[model samples]
Target: MKSVTILLYDGFSNMVLSCLLEPLRAVRDQSQSALHWHIVTPHDGPARSSSGLNIAPDLACKDVIKSDLLMVVSGYGYRQHAKPENLRPLRLLTRQAASIVAADTGSWLLASAGLLDDQTATIHWGVISDFTEEFPKVRPSYERFVKHPRISTCGGASTALELMLAMISEQFGPADAFIASTMFLHDAAQQQSTGRGPNRLEGKGTAQLRQIVNRMVETIETPLSLEELAQQSGLTRRTLDRLFQAELAMSPGRYYQLMRLTHARELSTSTDYDLREIALRCGYADASALGKAFRKAFGHPIRKSRGSRPH
Candidate 1:
């Protein structure tokens, strides 16, 4: 998106704002998009962070012309900031913004403005009980973040980063998101859908499941047998199968294949490895076998998707 308006209020989280902006900065640097943003406060002057940092605004909220994306960020005392003067401008901005994001306590302001009526949303976990009691019509999800086409809400910095990456993936492509995710050293162990079908292996779940997935990642070049996988995780095949199916909605075999293919895709995009080498690295016996599986899943040969890129 070209134009972004970040609406801040007093007592916002400095770290939350950093998490929101840093990923966008990374996307701007990594992608071909001409993304830019400006900060705004409800009235004027500056917004103070919970950590005692003062950030002067670029413009008043009422003066915002338009925004491709509007981000509402706040922390303590967000309810008091939802007075008529602020709500009036927030409602107007929401109607104009193509997409909306509420990070940390900002969802409270959006809910107060009646913007979250009848929508499934989430807020920082600490305030979720109060949020539920305050907004009876809104359906609340305990997800780290709930992202839809028009609006999204998240709890903390890590979830905010995932939300930004999801938006980047939706707008640009997964490759850019992947680069940023890895570059940030984001654990990415989120449990939610993320609006993108996340690799559950790289996400949050039970310790045993994580143990198996870690083994899978480590054995990409020489995939472990299901028997070996189960043994390493200290479980039987049936138990492992049940766990993957129940949690990730897939059989262990299928999840392992997805892991291999996803790893293969990443390697193809980020490196100059030949198909045969990439195939071998991803645990495929040879180029032909890898080609068959890769095409079946991704709808194209790896060579074609690789294309010409920087080494």
Candidate 2:
């Protein structure tokens, strides 16, 4: 039997919490792993999310028993909750638990407790610069997740799901992990699969198509022309067009344009970069060109996407 303990804080993301728990529960249901979890808080009672969803904890932090894995979950307003008194239990767990995982901004709390010194870690990208500035001893990564020997960190809910799935594969087997992923409608091949399975895009299209897409993703800041992309994929322009049309229902040019615009939208929402800077990063000649393309693809002005993000 593997035991897991989750320390929840007020204003934690309910979605992130569920992403970690649901897959493990599904694995337990299908296999004989006997995976169990206990939710703990600084005080024994309900912890509410920013959206008002409430979760009841099974134990107070001071009363938590040792577990194979201890995960700290934090979201908005994490700084206010990461006081010394509230972190005492976590500091104690560092010596007791087998491994510690930080989810979302929980990395900030762990670093505050000096648990991540000299350890490679990652927090949500939106706060990564702040995390690095505050904790210089902790090596911060731009990856979606980082897994060290005794400590791990994840950037957000989706990466947390990936981390848990990888842990499940290590404990059980790849087959069991695949089953759990399928239950969640997640295609394991698209991710770093735990088991030796076919990639999600393996049979969906030719290898050339996958290669072309990867190239586009890598060069988002300086996009390649359609002819250049075709040459790199070792295919003619016509074949590239045919393959993309058959596989993605769009031309290679359209798909590439959409990819760049999608990246532009992410930058707009997640960072404070101005339109001119974002446009240059996305390979646009100017802000006007970027705005025209963004509106065409997403049906809204770029400013609207920036304004819609939570303040």
Candidate 3:
């Protein structure tokens, strides 16, 4: 079981807090690994967010005994919140927690406490120059997030969600993380790469592309070759490839392979089927064949990714 503690402060960003909590909510619902969380403030009082929403603490920060993960989430007014009274408990809890994560200006608080002296961390980009000037010892990156073994930091609200998803995938396996992403319809990887929201592609030009995706979804168990897909869709192979690349951003063959692998992963996690059976059902030749592709896609073998079906 993983016990998570959120150390929230006044003037926090509600969106950043939600981004930190929502992925944990999804994993607690879908993960085989047990997870629990509690929210707390400096003195067990209500804290107001930047958007004027108030959150009452479940406990005080000093009351915390230990935590598997400690999340420090602050936004505006972080400078004022860096007093020794607040930083003292934060330093203690950070030392005891298995991992320490900070969002937005949260890294400012940690660095102020001397908790991140030797860590390479990222903070809200707007404050990079000030942060570097303030904390000469801590290396600051301008990336969306930085994931270190013991300490990690995210730059903003959306990156908070991205960091949580990666942590979820690490602790509960990629299958659970993928399932959690479905719950929110969040595509963090694509969003990061494209610097835009998910492309719905629900336009007149995408009718055929949508049909092709639907076909891929329907044929997960018996994937069709690119030639077969083209013939069935009344498209030449070149046209089929163009349609997928222009909309879905991958070739027909690559999409079909991914489709089959996803189903294979679902079965591995949610059912009692052995690897050989799952491979055959997902259109692979055997366990070895599926293992090769699965490792490539998820960076883990199917056996290691298996877990009790989430209740």
Give the candidate number with the greatest TM-score.
3
Q: What TM-score does candidate 2 reach?
A: 0.60
Q: Which lDDT tens digits does candidate 3 get at residues 21-78?
A: 8878766644434688899886578989998999998877777899999999988989
Candidate 1 lDDT tens digits, 1-311: 88999988788998889878887876665443578999988767888889888999887777788899999998888878876676876787888799999999888889998889999999999999999999998899999899988889998777887788878777766545544554343243322224333554334365566556667767889998999889888889999889988865568887788678767766777897888998999999998899999777655577765663455
Any idea how many clashes model 3 has?
0
lDDT of candidate 2 over 1-311, digit per residue (tens)? 38899888888888889888888886664443557889887566898887898889887766766889988999998887777777876787666789888999999999999989998999988899999999999999998789887889998888888888778777775544544554443232324244444554422345556567777877888999999999988899999999988965568887778667756776887899999999999999899999998776555688876864557
Sorted by TM-score (best first), the order is 3, 1, 2
Worst 10 residues of 3 by lDDT: 184-193
Q: Tell me each candidate's TM-score.
A: 0.63, 0.60, 0.66
Clashes of 1: 0
List lDDT for all candidates, in order.
0.78, 0.78, 0.78
lDDT, residue 33, model 3: 49
- Which residue pairs does candidate 2 place in steric collision? none
Pairs in steric clash, model 3: none
lDDT agreement of model 2 with the native: 0.78
Name the TM-score of candidate 3: 0.66
